[model samples]
Target chain A: MVSRIGKEIELSPVEMASRYSSRALYNLAAGSPDPSTIPVGEIMNSYDRVLSDLGPRALGYPGAGGQESLVKEIENFLPFLGLSIRKGERLVVTSGAQHAIELIAKYLLENEVVVAENPTFVETLTPMKLRSSVVLPVSLDERGMSVDELESLTRTVKVSIVYIIPNCHNPAGVTTCLERRKRLAELAEERNFYILEDDPYRPISTGVPPPVKSFDNNGRVIYVSTFSKILAPGLRIGFILANQEVAEKLALLEQNDFSTSTINQYVVADLLKRGVIQGRTEQLSSHYGRKMKILVESLRENRLDDFNPPSCGFFLLLNLHKDADSVFHTALTKGLLFVPAGPFFLRGGETYARLSVAVAQEEHIVKGVRVLKEVLSQD
Target chain B: MVSRIGKEIELSPVEMASRYSSRALYNLAAGSPDPSTIPVGEIMNSYDRVLSDLGPRALGYPGAGGQESLVKEIENFLPFLGLSIRKGERLVVTSGAQHAIELIAKYLLENEVVVAENPTFVETLTPMKLRSSVVLPVSLDERGMSVDELESLTRTVKVSIVYIIPNCHNPAGVTTCLERRKRLAELAEERNFYILEDDPYRPISTGVPPPVKSFDNNGRVIYVSTFSKILAPGLRIGFILANQEVAEKLALLEQNDFSTSTINQYVVADLLKRGVIQGRTEQLSSHYGRKMKILVESLRENRLDDFNPPSCGFFLLLNLHKDADSVFHTALTKGLLFVPAGPFFLRGGETYARLSVAVAQEEHIVKGVRVLKEVLSQD
Candidate 1:
């Protein structure tokens, strides 16, 4: 009874991560924030105050985009991430960054060709893939998605969209440099295609450059970011900054999901109001930074292919350069869980493994690395 | 660059309601609940307790379906609405009942022919229309959507699905009779077509017979209901009770939206756990009941064509028996507002108006009806 698109739907990485988080003693898979970093008491207080102060007003219909106060807060917060809302631009709040991508993919892409990093985040990629006729993946260098290849490909294929994770690129951990960001923005304008600059990890990711959207003179870049990384995924708050016309159109599509949860907006808005998020942001940076450090050091000390650690955010990806399937099975028996990077790529990532430290304690990260080393040495 | 489906998306009734609720002095348009009865303090308490108790755990990634506690709560609460989760039946929580419709419409529906009531809830119908090749409208009688017409429809058209708003029908406040419900269930089985029993207002609706799902021996009926009407739309919580296979399929589709807000789920589960919703249910019935009474009485006392009031839920549709365009315009000029029934019907409903008492207080309901009566009498 399901449709063709429905049949094509697979278990997303987020779902796989959730399973690993629960089942594994040493969970190195999920990108979910470490529970310790979430400001529980602050969130609770903000929610209490919002519910009490707004009464039923908070729970009533939030109209099209979102709670007005939250929208303003989001606008204010965007500048901190080196993004500014330009004239003739507006914002639409979505359930999450993933939802923002779904709206763009389903509404904007007309079964046309899409371009993304070769190892893209398929959680977002699946929606775009299902909607579009084809997704052409560009190779990634140290500076992020290779716009040079994208520029070359644009000669043959009329690309409708270019989706990129600018900071701490998933499965590759390459931040787009400033030079590349400007070139990508220029490429988008020249090609008359949209650039979906997906930047969910910016708050936690270090050594970030200005987002590609920041450089776009035209309204070609749609900046998608979320509270899930900084605040909590349970908050399910995200927004997209786009041209006013595009934002209005996406808001119409958003009516189908009704609106993002009213209570959540109030809480997040209140959290911003009370300046709780900044503190939470620092806490997250330190928390994830410490874990990433331990994992990278363990990898180095154990002489497992020497690589620099991701500056911040979740876990770093490892290019196993060996058969991933057997290693994965062997590790599964020992209860050390890590996400295989093959699913993150639309094509050609069969041997890579993404090891997330989002849920792992330091000891587990150390021990999990030891197990990975032993597993790799057996080959 | 927008897709055809995106181009076809319209401003839904929920969006329209949000606009009217904000702009109108006396809103007789929005189906949003009366602010006075929303159990604000109770919700505040529940939210506070849940956050304090669950803390970071509440804000983490909820797996595919929903928070386990909330699912159990929803399951326990199902019996009160004359629905039950039978053996081999499962549930998947959604952002809202509107969202449930979108999921089923998008994932389950192919470009097949769909059947809905002539004057159906377009908020839900729009998604179905966008997905399906055609939507055949069945006539509605005093006993709700005419089962005989649906039976005839199946003969002429190979109907893939039959959609119905079973209780306190959105524009027509009639409930389905048990006999018709049984026959519809049987027809669905005999014809091998799915039945989407949309029952958002079931908790507040009165004189509702056992739902069509109750009569189904086979899993032909997918029950969609929400906490929006009974609790608040701000909660943005709803669920679909379907066969395990069907539920699993829908859950996989849900991974796209990620999951419904975890905090909202925790708050709702807490409300259910504390039995606050039962008190809130009684509160809503009496509160809406009084406003509805005032609106109905004013309509009759002013010698407007007499009509029966909806037993409960948000609004009652008046067969304006006049050019609805002029009536609506005149009412607008006089600072009174109501929904024109034109958009509610896919076919014809040119002269009807739907008057809601959901948001208006008793005095406003009385005054709004007076203005509406004067506008109608001028003809």
Candidate 2:
């Protein structure tokens, strides 16, 4: 008796991800944080400290929104990371950034039209699609999502939400320029639509502009980000920064999960109290930055595929100029792993493939590119 | 553009619950497990060990359904607790029992008819209501939710799901008899409806009959249970046992949360591997058993109100024979907290209140009843 959702989880990309075995393959396919950058010792200490301090309360339901100490830490740290709740806005802790997207899609979408980039993260779009939202895919340019296209699309059909990555877009790592961020906010204000600014990659993405939310004077931008990129994905800590009304609605909706792991929240709170998150995020930014640079340099040196080198963040998309299926399969058999682009879009991207430098070391990045060149040349 | 959820979170019941202060008030209104029963040392050791061993993977995504070690532990422990996921069955770990319910309601309820016990747990109903399901409240007799009413209701409307708290039912704390369990399963097979056997209180509840899921041969029953009663809720671990197809579908749905806490899962897994849960649960069963007995005896001794003594589990519903509003208010001022019945029902529960003995000590139970007696006599 399942209610048939409009979109289903595509196994092709996931299968590509699985092919990237940890010790076996030249893995450039995962979006996971760099293992070296995770604050293992500090996280261990924080867990011990939180468990000892909070005792049983750490394992209980953390109130309506979240644990007070954790919320305060988030508020204290967000501004330094270029997010600000300010005046009438509030926040709610979530399981992860995906859970944040699910809340907005499940409660606020109302089956209205949503706009996303042509080649975007499928994970971000799945929950929105599950809510039966009519999706309009907008293409990205050098500046990011074309505001002119979004403005034109709004005239044709009523758009309720516009989901934007803004910084280090998945599959296609394109950072929105400051002008585009402001323009996106302006468009949301003019259209009376909400801008779901998904900023999961921002903290680890180098030189990110202020969030679209900063430009949203009319409270049309809902900011969502996660600790997955900077801290650890397994921690499953993400938060939504929205207007108090919407935040309250989300908090009430979050009651559905009982609460995101209270112990996890408290541990994160302990880390934040010690100011570990800031130093760790800076370390992650540089670690991923160096890896992204190595990947780009090797790809350029080989001159195997047509792609723009991303300034920062985990992923870069290669335009294979033809179907990437043969290239992907041949590369996989050769012990190199990168995701095919078919699953990252509403319809197209058959001629593209996404390469991730998130978990790859400098050697793997260079070696992975050499293998990709061999596969591409043969294809 | 927030979707107007049909049932807004009832503040009244939540407000009644909130009136329970931790340190000062005699908290007979909470479903929280006793802090004394929490295996703090074991959990702390487990977390430290899992993190030290697994390193970065401990804090990364636990994969599709859950962490492998945790799922295996669930597979092992469930049968010991009288829940058997035999051939063709599968399980997916959730954030909590509430998350398991949310998944079913959001994905399966297609706004179809749902039958729940009269004065059911509101947190469970809130998610179902959000999915626009037409909920039909069925009253409970000694055995549990009246199967006759359920059978009659199914004849008129297509009942998609019947949510049952089989063992130590919340609010009422009524255990469905073994015959009733078999009958519920048979009714589901005949009706082509699903039975969501919510058994959060089973491990601690004394003399619980085998679950309705155990009686089903047709794969029509989905079992939902949690570690909150036996362990700590702040860990936020719960699971669902269903047919492989449904389990896969639910796992696909769970991709929205990225994953439940990986660290928490590993910690729980470590504890399970060490067989800490078996001993801990037995201790909890006896500890809570004594508390329930004391509360019932004290109430009977004082002749405070009308209530059938619960054999086990956390709660007991007292029939006040009059509206409990004034009595509740007066009791609260005199340092007592018990949840008023208004919030537990679909419509009417004015003459009742649900008392919980989960966290209270023997002294608090006796003193709470005396307070109740004084409040009742004043009214």
Candidate 3:
């Protein structure tokens, strides 16, 4: 007897990409980093050290909110964002930033209203849809989520939470300006709504503004970040920083999966202590920056479409005059692959496409963009 | 503005243990395995081999159902229970068996009625309570969940799922008879209810019968197992085996976390390939068997309490003459630790206590029993 799943649990873009992974050539549909950049050797060293030092305790069930030392390490690391771990602040390590978001949606936002950017990270929207009754999509300009539109929506309907990717916004590649960050935080305080600042792409990106959490003085923002972008996705280490009350609630919700992987947490803690992640993030920023530059220059040289080049992060959002879905299908046949922006929005995004420069090599980037150029020219 | 979590999301036994972890001298509270029994070196070797062989690919996102090779390894390993992986069967890897149970409750039993053993694994009940409107607790005799009670319950209330821990059942230490297993499977098919056979403790235990899944021929049983009890809990690797349709649904539910750790999956796959887990299981069974013997003999000599010595698994269920909660508090003062079974039951279990011989040394088991004997005698 099979149980029926809700529409929200159906296959999304990530699963679709994974399903047709072998058929894809350029493979830019999912936002996975270049595999070569992962520090396998360093991680191996960390594993050895963690296992040898801790023995079987490393394999034991981790404390709720994960290992204390790792939480402390994250506390020490947060100063890099111009944010300090306050006295009453609590950190709960999660499977990833997505899991952290899911926990918040499940425990806090039941039957509530959530506001997200129009072309947002689709995976984050799934949890809200499953839990909240109303998921409002606000339009985004170059500076990121239009506060005027958000305010206009909030005046009519009470918003419980606002989900945002402030730094290097996914699918759009537009960073929220410092002014917008302050205004968003202020609006969250004024409207008495929680802001879930999902900032996974911040660590490995350069010239990024501090997270909206840094500007939140009234404990209105819950900061979520992941090592998936900066370190390794397989490690599945992420943490949430919130007020003690909210953090305790999150920890209670985390009891669903017990604690996250204890070995992974210890391995990450060792890496953080050794400053391995800090050094790697610097290397990754430059490496991805170069790839983004190559993809942008190739697109401009081919005189195909109009788009703003992202200052940092793995993706470049192309605003095409043609339908993105048709172009995506045509380019797929011509051995090029990238995510169409249609699925990213709750409403309309037909002319938008997101090209990830993370997975492809320099030569592959050049080839893939040329194929896109050829397909668009024919149209 | 901290959002309030529902009362159902309050602190459970696991969280209670974590909150006072430092206070407990002898931690028999949770059923964690002995550190010495963990095959740390072999697991480390597996890690080394997996990382080197697969490199950064091992660190990337796994397939929706998990790594194909690991799924195959699990499929190959399942024949020990007299069950073969049928062509139409599929496997979805989970963070743990608990997570597998959670997914089943979330996706399969929403707003439905669930039948669980009265004194079942407390963590399993959490998800069911969160999702299902009616969670009926069926009584368990020495042969495990009473089929008569379940049948009677199902006659009145429509049960969507029957969750049972057939082999070496958690908290109760009672294994279901083969006849009961067959009947339960039959009843599930007849009642049109799914059976979630959670069997995490089967591998490392001795003389355990085949799982209920072996008796399930009509695709009514969904088998959930984990590497936590046998290999290492820190790896957080488990699998769910079901018919293709149900398996696909489970994979869709697994999308919440995206996938389990890829590196851990690869490591487990390598261990299975090398037969390390098979060899280690034999060693662990003997090692834990000796500890169980010591605990039983000590309890008998000291006239501590009446109990069924668990033939397999980590726990021994003690039937105390005195109140279990009072005895637990008294034992704590005397530096002895064990779980009061009152919390495990949905109804009355004030006199039942659970002792875990998994974590303590042989001397500690004897000493703890002596202390427990003294504390009970005082009443």
Model 1: per-residue Cα lDDT at residue A119: 85
In order, what DockQ does each candidate have?
A: 0.75, 0.63, 0.56
> Total clashing residue pairs per candidate?
0, 2, 0
> Could you tell me which 10 consecutive residues in candidate 1 chain A have the lowest summed lDDT?
A306-315
Please give, for residues A179-238, the per-residue lDDT of candidate 1 as tens digits.
988999999988999999899888876457888888989999999999898889988889
TM-score of each: 0.97, 0.97, 0.96
Alpha carbon deviation, residue B207, candidate 3 (Å):
2.8
* Candidate 1 interface RMS: 1.4
Tens-digit lDDT track for model 3 on A249-356? 888777777537889999999999988887776789999889988988998888854776677888777877789888888888877778888878889888888889
Model 3 residue runs over 4 Å out of place are: A1-7, B1-6, B18-25
Report interface Cα RMSD per prediction.
Answer: 1.4, 2.4, 2.8
Question: Which candidate leads the pack in lDDT?
Answer: 1
Top-DockQ candidate index = 1
Please provide, for model 2 over B227-324, each residue's C-alpha lDDT reduced to its tens digit, 9 standing for 90 to 100. Answer: 88887888888899998878877877777665478888888888878888766766778888888889888988987547766767889999977677
